[model samples]
Target chain A: MSSILKITDLHIAVDGKPILKGVNLEVKQGEIHALMGPNGSGKSTLAYALAGHPKYEITGGDIEIDGASLNELDANERARLGMFLAFQYPVTIPGVRVADFLRHAVTNRRDPDRKEGENLMPMREFRQELRGRMNELGMDPEFARRYLNDGFSGGEKKRMEILQMAMLKPKFAILDETDSGLDSDAVKVVSEGLSSLAGPETGVLIITHHERLLEFNRPQFTHVMLAGRIVETGDASLAHELHANGYTTVRERHPAEAAEEQAEREETLATV
Target chain B: MSTVTVNSAPSLPSGFTSDDFEVFLQSRVEPVWVTQRRRVAFELFQAKSAEELDPEEWKRIPARAFRPEKFSLTGKAAIGFDTAQLPLMQNRAEFEGAVVHVDGSATESRLTEQLAAKGVIFGDLATVLCQQADLLEPHFATKAVLPDTDRFAAWHGAFWTGGTVLFVPKGVQVDAPLYSLVALAQDGVADFSHTLVILEDGAEATLLEETASGSPDIAGLHVGAVELLVGKEARLRYVQLQNWNQKSWHFAHQCGRVEGNGSLQWTVGGLGSKLAHIHQDVHLDGRGAEAQVNGVTFAKDRQCLSYYTQQTHNAPDTRSDLLYKDVLTDESRVIWRGMIKVEPEAQKTDGYQRNDSLLLSPTSRCDAIPGLEIEADDVRCTHGATAGRVDVDQIFYAMCRGLTEHEAMHIIVQGFLQTVTDRIPVELVRETLDKAVEVKLGIGE
Candidate 1:
């Protein structure tokens, strides 16, 4: 049976302020979903919420895999359950080599019940797999010995995220703005990398602003979020139309939600 | 020999007194010069012990509960005690020489005949001083770690029991490295083991030393001193791993001096002790001298570890770099006060000192202060100190990659200490430090 990630009326808040209200989405295996929205529309919030970020409080609604709820799980537990998030800004852990970090990550993902201090995957096996993955992604094998993301360029950071995604091979992978802050060449590399990684066994949710990414992966479902709600859901054309014309028409079409977004903007402006 | 237990019966003197000093003196057989030096040092110890400690260095460390009289020098050697289990660098590599001291008495001392034939002296201080009195008389307690520096220095000078001494003749290089183990086997026994390394002009050597307790719950006291003297164009690498049990009090005055064009690489690992305070000093005494100091300390539970370090450049074209990394957890506290001093004649000198600390728990605390006193107008001196808890974002990032929270923390802590570990060039030292870190984190064998 193909695994399904179901988000039912998810109401999320940050520091006691509501951000995601009554958001509903469903993604099944072998499918690609695109999450598009204007700024502050909770696109990244939804991504972080799904990844079990401690700061993103799920005040209401349930996020489930198949039928089991992930409300009580932390990020590590979620990761062990085959939920992966390719961060918008991948964190830099100094003095930690890429190979060592991945060995632990891959070992934990492969053996979910493994306790701390248990043996990791053998070095020869893990190194071979990592080297192969790096080669497939056109990365220099020497990059595996460098500190994890420390002093990496913008494009290199993005590619590192993709590399982690490829290595973990999660059941459901969420790319949270993986293409943002990258040049055209980097975007192409990332897009191509994602294209090769997502297959029949994986479910992908690409939260992005650039149509360049969707142009390659070609999402089957495009959902537009405004005022912390998914105001519109459509096929590929909807994404292309939104990308070409921007969200003005969508705002006009959803007056109530757009008004709420406008009020939120003004309130944020007032606080600033 | 028989073992004498002196830890019991509080009716004895509460601290080091005139009677204890005399008794300690009578127990040792040495030359008249050594006895005269002890008399001077014993008077200094008495005076200094009565005076208040410098508040600048002792404000953060609470020593009011310390009862020095509870510990005494053992009259007889501790026999038949096994020291094979004390970890760190033992049986890990081949050494040119190895020395073991138990309860402030030499239990074993050996040196490869090849090195001994090459005019290298490696043995206990008592044996070496007796055999080579004319050769060692000038350098012993005279160049570095002066007896008048503080109470601990004077105390160690007056009553030092047994220690390791390594002397390499001019133009000779001892390549395989030497090992020293100082073990405390009896409760309430004070082990004042002194280490002195002297390398003549154009000579080179490396010495690795460690201190450990026979059992985890035995109460011990260590008032130790280490003096390293490097001659012109000579090089020396010294590592001291302080791995005492939690029921021990460790006080040490360690110093090193580098001559013209000589270099000293000093690494200190502070892993164990209930309370430890070390005053470390490095002197660039001649032109073009250089020194590199590395410190890695981990404090857990209710332990308190403090370090007062100074780097003094006295000649032109001198250089010194110091880096200390500390990790504290539970209710432990770590304090580091560092200074770089440049003399007026030391123009064009380069000095740098930095200390970074990582706190792992809410109650764990660290106090780091870096200062510089530069009288040379044409010198570059920089100092920095930073103390922060482990970044939650870094932890979360690691956790997202499938590590449990504890494992993630362990990895981050290891990463934090890797910067200083990189500065150490010895593979044996690096590997031993890694294993010590793992054991301290409660994760490895």
Candidate 2:
């Protein structure tokens, strides 16, 4: 199987306003790609669009997973197609317990082609798998008894997302700002956890605004997005360059794109 | 829209005329005062029909849609129901006292020797009326709830054949909880039962009353009443579980009065009935009294459940808190109209009530109206109502793990209703409610 995600001339919009315009990318299994950008640079947009978020409209271009189109699929369908997007802000469901929710998710995702009501993991095995993964992530044993994401701290929510990643083990995983709300020590823990969870057959696209996360989970390629477009692409050294000299050189390198973004912002402010 | 049939008045049930009432009256033996009250109630019931005046909000309830003529009053005699065969009430050795009533007749009555020594009265109403008429008369259908309150009360007053009378004497604290099972087994019969609980000064006890039917889809009618009298400094935990069959239409009027420094904890579970309408009220009548009311209603498959609750703070320095949660699925509908009223003299009172509705199906509808009427100055009163569908993302999140839609729904619903079930302090009662939830969801398989 060709475990490659090919994105060509992708034009995406939010509520009819263009966000990711003519974006192009290619991701293959057994590789890690880091997506870094300023605020509103459409980094998260690419992740959400690939995850089939209804609000992010794909106006042009196509996303192909091993030559299969995912433009018309729903989030769940995309997930079944070996694509996963960890939410930047996980929604809290008051009544549902964490352990039970994950069991059902794991049950359905393991056999992607299994028919409904077939191949559900028995309770004993499911509980053991859940506890094993939870312990690996250093999550409290009682965490499974708590309601999903209800009253959880910021770092806890981030760790929960990573724990889910460890359990689901999708072919392609997109971690959106997984270290946003975490302290340095917590970020190191999450990065290490993600490293151990992924393998030769797994592909990861880490979206972030800081290079701190990239220190632990080294990405093979680093891409910088500005105003809905990826302007520069380089090896891991590019991230070190950005961390040292900052994005000043990228802005200077892509003056045309920068000018266009300034004009768009002015027009939006005028309309408002 | 114009294809609907409109009836201005609902007719009385077939074969239930004045002559039938006379026959029913003559068939039973009772005291003169009881007979007089029955005659008065029957007269009032005859003079009025259910359509004349409604609670306005009760329009959501399907009680009026039922034709009284469809059910037969002359059902198999109440004795035809065998309580001993009930699987629900079979393994209850932990209960201090156990009384089982089948179709308005006591089939089993037993009490621990220690409770009997303490003068704890746990028996059928008919037996109480004969054995302790002096203590029973002063509280039955007199103060906690009047016989002339409504049609259901009047009907119960005219024909209350089988019920429970539990009396915990002054300062007597029964260590083990008492249990009562009111099971409707026969077809086309009306169950007019009453539970009158009287707690003397400084007494404390726990009581669980379960309403269930051994058969499913058996046409049944239940017009019942429950009156709890918590005397000064007394404490009582009252748990009522209503799990009738799908073919049953039930109506109940339940009220409790708390005297000075008394405390009342009332937990209710409504998981059955094709159509049910109930009015539950609590009055903090004496100073320093406190009351907490909690209930869970699980409705499924074209069922209509309605509950009208009121917490009236009538005395100073009293507190009342109420929380009721409902989970509805299929084409089921639920209505909750709750009010917290603080009187002028009830200063320094704190009253709170909240009703939340969880809709499992798109077609299920819920109406939760919460209100507060306060005439007192120094008081804290709050009420809230929420009606919402189960969060879709929650379902999707669960499905992503490996669960089918049905399995995900079961988990979400059980978690949603745990808010009220957890309030049931008694372990056994909570277990029974848990089993009911499992049965309703069809998940145990």
RMSD to the true structure for each prediction, in A, is 3.7, 5.1
Which clashing pairs does model 1 show? B14-B69
Q: State the lDDT of candidate 1 residue by residue for B1-445, as single tens digits.
A: 1111121222324446778778877879887898889889888876776566777677788665567777888855667788877766886987879999999999999999999999999999988889999998999999898889977898889999899999999999988889999999999999999999999999999999999999899999999999999999999999999999999999999999999999999999999899999999999999999999999999999999999999999999999999999999999999999999999999999999999999999999999989999999999999998888888888888888889888888888888898999999999999998888888788865
The candidate scoring highest on TM-score is 1
lDDT of 1 at B420: 96
Worst 10 residues of 1 chain A by lDDT: A193-202
Report how far off residue A184 is in candidate 1 (Å): 1.7
**Candidate 2 local lDDT, B349-417, one digit each (tens):** 999999999898899988888989999999999888888888777665554444545666777777777
Report the CAPRI category for model 1.
medium
TM-score of each: 0.95, 0.81
Rate residue B271 of model 2 by lDDT.
82
Give the lowest summed-lDDT range of ten residues in model 2 chain B: B1-10
